[model samples]
Target: MTEALSSLAEAFKNVGVSRAYGTPVKVVGEELIPVALVSFGFGGGGNSEAEGADAAGLESVAGGGGGGFVLPLGVYCRNGSGHVAFRPNMIALIGTLVPLVCAVGFTARGILRTLRR
Candidate 1:
């Protein structure tokens, strides 16, 4: 329907990379925007049966679902000197780093073993 399409267009207009950045807040002498990584997904399907649609004249059984996640990554802060800096979320940093460190460690171990052999 045109109404549905127009609403969808409006939703997309409001949803974008900017959503990952939060409104600026001031703490002490600095202004900070809490930043996060954002993601979303959607899926839909429909199956039509004549028996299900006889009276209504609508045939297709339609369904859709979606999900999203936002992970706080850091903040962009502007200090008194008018300089901006990124301050990372330490826990999130470590959470990402551990897996990457493990992968690199395993790769290095494999390479060393192959060289020795």
Candidate 2:
């Protein structure tokens, strides 16, 4: 278990800021540092015995999982005047916003129903 936990910790370290920033690319006399929103997680499978259930119970296999997402947020680019500015990835931003908007709309509908009661 210690080894597994240690490995997970190392995995998180590798997934940190290093993955969020990319190698700088120079284009047309401008330098751009690509940026991304990185996210990840790890989980250890649960034990059926902890809940005091039968050894052959349905919860015997609590499968654990690890996953990650890297969404390119945009880049830090140096303009002609040497000022660094952030230019967002509109497509990725819109992809994220669509779900957010839907969630807000659903939440608003629930709140409106509660208020009407």
Please, what are the lDDT tens digits per residue for candidate 1 over residues 86-115? 999999999989999999999999999999
Per-residue lDDT value at 110 in model 2:
100
Q: Name every residue pair that clashes in candidate 2.
A: none
Clash tally, candidates in order: 0, 0
Task: Report, for every candidate in turn, its global Cα lDDT versus the true structure.
Answer: 0.85, 0.84
Instruction: Tell me each candidate's TM-score.
Output: 0.69, 0.71
Candidate 2 lDDT, tens digit per residue, 9-42? 8767666677899999999989999999987777
TM-score for candidate 2: 0.71
- Least well predicted 10-residue stretch by lDDT in candidate 2: 55-64
User: What pairs collide in candidate 1?
Assistant: none
